[model samples]
Target: MMEVPRDLFIPPDALEVFLDTFQGPLDLLLYLIRKHNLEVLDIPMAELTRQYMAYVEIMRANQLELAAEYLLMTALLIEIKSRMLLPRPIIRTNEDDLDPRAELMRRLLEYEQMKLAAQRLNDIPQVERDFTLVQVLIEQTVAKRLPEVNVDDLRNAWITLVVRAQVNRHHRVTRAELSVRSHMSRIMRDLRGREFIEFNELFGPSAGVAEVVVTFLALLELVKESLVEISQSQPIGIIYVKSTDFLTSV
Candidate 1:
């Protein structure tokens, strides 16, 4: 079994449904009239008073706090209902022949107009009510400040970075096959009959890094085998490459 706290103080009318819409009691009356399709000009006082009393009784049963104005309106409705019961003169007179609901109807019409006007005014969004007003403040100075970064800009930047990382992802390393033996044969053909060939002539201008490394290794192997000679005429002078066949002939 669950036990409630000793400090839990619930009010008698804590669970209350608020019916205070755009109009208060008048609005309730208007709603009843409209729902029943009763003409505002020729209101039936008996039915109106009965419905009003039923609502008042519900509020009373629920121990709802009532306003003096609500009680006054209730009394006025009863008086109108009673006046309707009173006998009228056989010969009709001005104002006396009018319905007892005339004054209440006049107020209801005026109240309805005001309510409609208020609703129209409420519908047209005003500052700080329906939407948040965005104001961009610009400060004037010799050194102008850069625009502030908003969440949307930051989010877009993050998305761009993710896309670029995916497109240019360097996760895989591919190994290319280059042969030093092939580069060696290429060098032998280039240095075939040359006594002194400029060092740069043996290498292509558009050689890739892998090809350049292979060519350098091939040149080193030729020099180790005493098949090619590399020489510089003077200090910091242009280097030259030559075959040992020329030196052997000399």
Candidate 2:
């Protein structure tokens, strides 16, 4: 018998031929069937076996280690091809003959379904890949409150001041000169350096009835001239006097 050389089956560029690697024999078989558009249930065993053997030869030539699963599938393909060539029995029965490709077809269909499901799961939105979660922090602040005063409270305070002045009144008659214009100028000078002043604080206990009256008139004249403002809050609260210059600047 003549011996064939081992190198005869291997191509010269076998090292350069890139083999399409697959997960298993079934994966390679499925790829081939799909590429050729062959029917899964009615596989053409002769053509399939020829192509499969050609791939196995390429693997061997490239020095690629063949797995046991690939070898088993190769044997099954050859057996199916050989059985297709043989004649069948003439005995009639209600059930049809079993297809050789039935098991392979079921496995391929299941694998394809699982592959599609995995792909769908991978496409779902992820925390970092698709979008990121955002968080915001805010700083809190404390509120401030200002004191309030009322008109009735100012009237009561004025009455008290007058009573106190009368209690400390002297019987000796003395004509102490007090001018409303001079008091007005003094009040304006006092208010210029300050923002607000309490209304009762403007008078002193030593100031007699004449000085208090003149000072009160001077304050009224300042209000009439729009130079100062008398403001209050509730029914009985501290009264405040503010310069119109401060109010305007604010």
Candidate 3:
């Protein structure tokens, strides 16, 4: 029995077919020419142009908007065809010989290079892995013990933060009088529904520099009132403010 060959042609109208498959007019033309096994250097513009126009017609008939650039390239192909038909005096210089297909070939090569480069970049590991302390898991039989350095350091840090937030009751006020209690009330009102606020961004351009100092004091009062939590994961790191309003009732 004789085996029949299957049709290899892909139908132009596939559902949800991404236009990205064809980079541009040049890419589409190249695909058609290659599919038919035609010579690139001597591309029969009349046949190629007809094939290209068929695609354009298919797109328009399907209510797909054809880009202006595709039309411009169609005009270019017609112009090149007309130029080839006209018998013009060829300039013969020993130094250079310019092929009519040179420009198109150059563009194709550049596009191909960029395509490969993009593929290579995509293949690279995107999410970088950083070693974390908790990743050190040991065998079940091994009697492993971990150091308590993080706990000790955290305890010392908590003590320091508490000490820093305490107001110096003995110090007398000079120049201007300010109360942390009033500032705390203002902050609580501002953050009633908001879950978080940047520690430094609460102030505006017109805000006096003293507002920063007052805000810090307000934050301390809020932390003490159990209405908010203040924390920094690392020294000189970004300070975080989380609403503990839910914890207040508990």
Candidate 4:
């Protein structure tokens, strides 16, 4: 310690020392490792712990507050140092293969990679930092914009359309499905006991046009198959449907 001279008034910030700042403990650890050219994978635990504790002492001497993270890292460094020096128990397990500094090395490597990537990004040319933006103002000769539509007018138009749709709405009749096979079987059964059946009597007026059409198709199919004969009693007389056997001489 040097003897202080009388009337030596030093300002609080006059003797301020600037230490290398780091983003976190990992950053500081990485700095130490790189500064000394030490291998991250094969780290010398004793030397690394000594230098780290020295930094913590320096921080204390400078009256800088040690963050919880820094303290935790300090404890970890000391623990790793001790784990290396002491003899590990002879346990036949995977723990034997695990290096105490493995976790630290992984974290440091990841942080260094990210830091390098960030440095590369920072080196890229930035818009505002590298150059100023140039702005120009021009007078508009003609500004054309589409007319705005009123919501009330659109609503009134929609209401008119709805009213017209309601007034012009027509009924949608979903006609029932009729089976031709069932109609054919029914016609055969009707003609079984009777010699002939009038075409008008075979079709029910209450049945829909679709059913009537299907019945007519079935009668036509029967005639085509020679299972039934459709013939007029006379010219312009009532049409009759009878079995082909009835028409046959046999």
TM per candidate comes to: 0.47, 0.45, 0.40, 0.48
- How does candidate 2 fare on TM-score? 0.45
**Residue 12, model 4: Cα distance from true site in angstroms:** 8.8
- CA-lDDT, candidates in order: 0.70, 0.76, 0.62, 0.72
Residue 132, candidate 2: C-alpha displacement in angstroms: 5.5
Per-residue alpha-carbon lDDT of candidate 4 for residues 1-250, written as tens digits (9 for 90 to 100): 2122233354557423223357888987887798778999999989888887787776777687778898999999999888888787877479867898999999999999999999999999999999888989986554322233344543443344445445544466775778998999999999886778876666654555566568778887897897987655444455667876655533
Better of 2 and 3 by TM-score: 2
What is the Å distance of residue 243 in model 2 from its true position?
Answer: 27
Report the error of model 2 at residue 39, Å: 1.6
**Lowest lDDT block of 10, candidate 3:** 1-10
What is candidate 2's lDDT per residue for 85-110, written digit by digit as tens?
76776984543386656776788788
Give the candidates in order of lDDT, highest first.
2, 4, 1, 3
Q: Write the per-residue lDDT of candidate 3 for residues 202-236, one digit (tens) a residue.
A: 44433443554676678777877878765555555
Best by TM-score: 4
Q: Which order, best to worst by TM-score?
A: 4, 1, 2, 3
For candidate 1, the per-residue lDDT at 81 reads 93
**What TM-score does model 1 achieve against the real structure?**
0.47
Top candidate, metric lDDT: 2
Pairs that collide in candidate 2 are 149-233
